[model samples]
Target: MPQLSVIVYGPNTQGHLTELLDSLDAHPLADAEVIVAAVGDWARETAGSHSPETIVVPLPDGTGDAAARAAGAARASGRWLHFVHAKDGLPAGAPRLIVERTAELDAMDTPGALAGPGAPDAPGAPVDVLLFDHVSTTWQTTAAPSGDGRLLAAVGRAGLPLDRSASLLRTAPLLGNRALRAAFWRAHEEEFTTDDEPYAACAALLRAGRVACLNQVAHEKRVLRPESLPPLAPEDRLALIDRYESLLALTEDRRAARTVLYDLMVRDLVRTFARENLPDPVAREFFHRASLAAVRWRPEGHQRPAGLEGVRHSLLEEGAYTRYRAFQAANRTRRAARKALRSRKRQVSVKVRDHQYRRALSRPVDPHLAVFTAYWDRGVACNPAAIAAKLAELAPHIRRVWVVSKENAALLPPGTDHVIPGTRRYWETLAGAKYLTNNVNFPGAVVKRPDTIHLQTHHGTPLKRMGLDQMDHPAAAQGLDFAALLARIDRWDYSVSANSHSTRMWERAYPARYTSLDHGYPRNDVFYTATAADVRAARARLGIAPGRTAVLYAPTHRDYEAGFTPRLDLAALADRLGENTVLLVRAHYFYGGAASPLTGLRRSGRIIDVSSYDPVEELCLAADALVTDYSSIMFDYANLDRPIVVYADDWETYRTTRGVYFDLMAEHPGKVAHSQEELTEIFLTGAWRDESAAKARAAFRRRFCEYDDGRAAERVVRRVFLGEPEEALPPVLPPEERTPAPTPEEATA
Candidate 1:
């Protein structure tokens, strides 16, 4: 049996695994064996081809990253364990280091049962470094001396050495050992997992005995794409606030929690309003209502740690209520400007006599259902498959489908003649849509129309908040006050999109009852298709030439309110593509309605602006490569097997400005580029040639999309059109048993 059971997860790094096997094959400890717990058949195949002697454990699909780690542990036979991802590489001499530590533990008359090589050294001796991190890789080293136990505990408490360096452990207890390594593991195995950074932090802190930090740069932490940084999502903002509160409570420190909470709350409020492309009328009203809400819900007693008093003090000194008043004043000015503009556009129209007799004589209707599908102004504007699926289900029985928008149009679904508009003629259009459904929440659609029943099929997955929207933001201080701005929002539709992360926000933000489902964009059904070959052939039939692989580079709009110009050097990008590869640049939907930055790309021989093309249609027949930053295209792209590259040059600023749904760097399985050169390299060479690319793809698929059997549209048709209950799919959860935290009510009670 192998001395160390190296359990690896993720398929993206299968190529890296091949390289790793070649590197490890030359190790001096030829006696040691390797065990790989792979996520898929691809991973297993990759590992098997390199080291057939290696024991391979196939992890269950849909078990999630954390569960895969636990499963690997359950199956390992080695006395010592080394758990990591395929993307992570061991230092040149990691095996020797682990073996040496195990040997040392074996040699001592009574060794410390849990001695790791890289932890801080004892006061007298030097600490052998085990883990070293670089710009893009991680290495496990073996060069730390023994350390005092108390020091280890202190460092753990302080949250020092945030990264988990490659750690070496003793298989058995040594100096005055309490229990064998197996026994120790059995007691703590439940605590181990691989759920991004925060979860990793929680697991590392909760378990482990006599932990050590090898300060050496054994690990090379790669620079992710600009869109991948500041991984916390809009929904995560609330959770992070709760986390800080928990940390403060653990330490019994009120000041610290208060400070962190205050800063996050203020920043969230600012970001919510700053990021929205609200009409002046809506923006003003939203600001007013938010200001009022802030004044009403004054945060009182959340604990705060001491050194962080400055945050709380600033809030007090600045006068939270006063800030809200200032917001209100600004919105008042905006409202005045909007009113003046309306006066100029207002046209006198004759009021028609009320035909009460004719209206009252109208035919009575059947049971009504309103569907609202809300979407961000990026990606494919509409999910046609979802719409078709819905239409297929409800066409004969359902009355009509009302497509709401900020601007009015007489657009209707194909094959349907029941067309309605929602711009300035919202009431007239809505009068016919008895059953209201929208992609996301547009309060304007349902707030006043009490007779219509509303059902929301949110356009995409939850990733961030929009407008002046957040539970933490005060109503009065709200930058985009929904109440005051109700008219503006109501102009579009009624509904909001949500996933597990932002589920609560849906209910909290809207006064009306909200519903959620597991289905993704109605349009994304194109990517999840049995007709992939057909789609490819369809593109061939179109002007898209044969033998040319397609690449879609889609980026979001800047709003210009964020004080940044929306620009991309398309010429530079086009110059980098291979002869057979074509680049499709999809600008943000809003940007598409304005001056486009894709002229340069369009001028190039292979690059084309897909701004006017429906994304689902384009994605179906047009892409072999995908490049995006902060847009939801990644989620849909995962349904296809094409490579994705994130060109997020403004990731850090965007996170600070609008926040994110998750950590892109840790979760996204693609090449991230911060510069044009990096973007070109990622698109041209790194995507396929780099061993780590495969692991990245695996991570992306697992997190953003899975179980795409090309029947997603069929599933939706069954559920929505047939009025089936949402039991067709299982709830998505990691395999690990998570301990649920207490709700506010439960804690108070």
Candidate 2:
């Protein structure tokens, strides 16, 4: 019979095993045999060094905690079993108290699985599991401590907080029928680590018999090492809240219920901010779902939480009234100040300082083909470098490539003429361009131009609310005045660049302008052909270790100046993957000079700030794995074929504030790592290199970039200049027809 079992999940630290053993050895009943189930060999070795008497069980590579625990249980022979992690320690007085409790329960009139003092000041003596007091001001540990673990909430009202006196009988009936436990665990193990839902379910099932807790503080839970898990995603919040609601439905203890609800609500608030700042469509979708869940809203179920009614009355209505009043006040003030401020003239178009525009216009326009580059917002996605390179590729023969941008000279590819004026001169700019191209939505409609070819190269294939399929947003009258803009868009602009997973969404969102072109930001072609040697060179230039796998984290900056203080757990992540993985932090161009508060991270030689990488090409090429919440570059990274992890830990508030164009959770092409631990697992395992992942990558290429043979610029020129349309573009090979690129030796043959 196993007296104690410690199940250590990876990538645990070097000293982690030592800490677990020392605590167990110090326990009052130190004579009890210790069983160690460790996933990684490093942890097992560490545990063995601390106590040779310890029985070391090596967990298989990919097995989860639940499965590992069951494996350990099967091999154990201790009279009582206690499960824990390498990082956790047993309570100071736990061993002696467990024996005493066992004796006391045995002598009692009715011997149950649990026998101990219960809730304080109740009609009866203290209940077995001591639940948290509703008014307790201390930060409550919602999840149970690993050492001397007991079944809480699931068995009864009181949440079992194991301290010195906490004990479980481990009797045959309490251990649950062997076959039943195995079957139940096998069926549900996959869902356990996903979120709190599986843990909640386990508690609900009452697999372990009546459990009890000691009111006295037993174990001092250690602070969580950083990088343990990826931060929570917006979707995670909704799932957690849903789990809490289900848990509440089962348990009768109001105090326990309130504690869970408080935690849920606080997490919901944090998630709201995360979504608002994510730049990608998928992240936006994550935000949309989380926002709906924050107020306990289920769009499909038509069920709303009772607490939402109060929110409707107090927050929503009051906010609307305040906004309206503020608007009225501002209007009144503007009217009175209008005459006095007459001398302040509106902003005019900026004058060019050089002869670049004149030289470009004089180059001449051929009627055979006209190229128009139009931009509505920040022109970063247009990949100015590639666009310039493409135009230069066609400069000798192709007639014209007119460039228009919302902000004049906003990242115009060099040698392209015609900078579109800002919002005030939008109509003027549209009229000047022979061809019109814009992404997502334009500021306002423009009169259709004659002989003008309209080609819409939409910015990206994001998965949040946007265009036609928006689920929730303020009335259209509010932002940018969509009605006027839609009416004026050039119907002839019949093309859009559909990136990965975008084929289905682009067609549905913009049926008219759908060309399904295989071209994304042409400048990314630079990275598509970038060599691993180039990555190494870039790292050397930056003075970072060449051996370390670079983790590039790029978070989009908010346009409204709404500060998003991202709490990245860098130290924790460094500790997990050892010292080999390096973190490169890059903020959006808009974040310009704002300093990141997540300091002291650079001291570890593990995390570095590379946001200064002007064009983002070097950073993209050097990164071994890309971790981002939302930024359009993910579309470009598809060309690299490296591991991609999305951190949309915040999804709700982002939708309500910024809005999404599509659903990221459903449409994204890679794994979603809502916590750091999951992210670290991916980094260490090269899990993205698996066969299934390769298949997904192939599918991704087929969907968005099938013709990427490093000849995108050449292909575009041939199609546009040589009068070739669909046939000019290379046909996407079927999966069976595809073959890996030959090595240099094979290519020479």
Clashes of each: 93, 43
Instruction: Score candidate 2 by TM-score against the native.
Output: 0.45
Q: What residue runs in model 1 are displaced by over 4 Å at the alpha carbon?
A: 1-381, 393-395, 404-429, 442-451, 467-479, 484-499, 502-512, 561-567, 600-604, 688-691, 706-722, 728-749
- RMSD of each predicted structure: 24.2, 20.5
* TM-score of decoy 1: 0.45
lDDT of each: 0.46, 0.47
lDDT of 1 at 164: 30
Cα deviation at 518, candidate 2, in Å, is 4.9
Per-residue lDDT of model 2, residues 1-749, tens digit only: 32333333332443555765765554324435566776676766666676666677777566665555656655655444444545544433343334334334324413223322232222332223221101001122211222222232223324233221122211111111111122223333444333242442333233222334332222333346345645755345345445544543433333443344434443444334333444455444543443444444222322333653333323322334344335546656887798556534331122331133333344433344344443344443353335435655665543453445544465545655554444323434444445454444444434454555555555545545445444245432235444444453436444435354565666664445435556544555665466546666666776677456677888764333322233345555666678777788886665443433333236467778776565576777767667877676776666666666777655555555457665656555577665555666766777755665666655555655544445555555455434477675755444345333322222223
Deviation of model 1 at 739, angstroms:
33
The sequence of per-residue lDDT tens digits that candidate 1 reaches over residues 226-313 is 4533454334333433333332232222233234434444444444555645555555554454444333333565343354343433
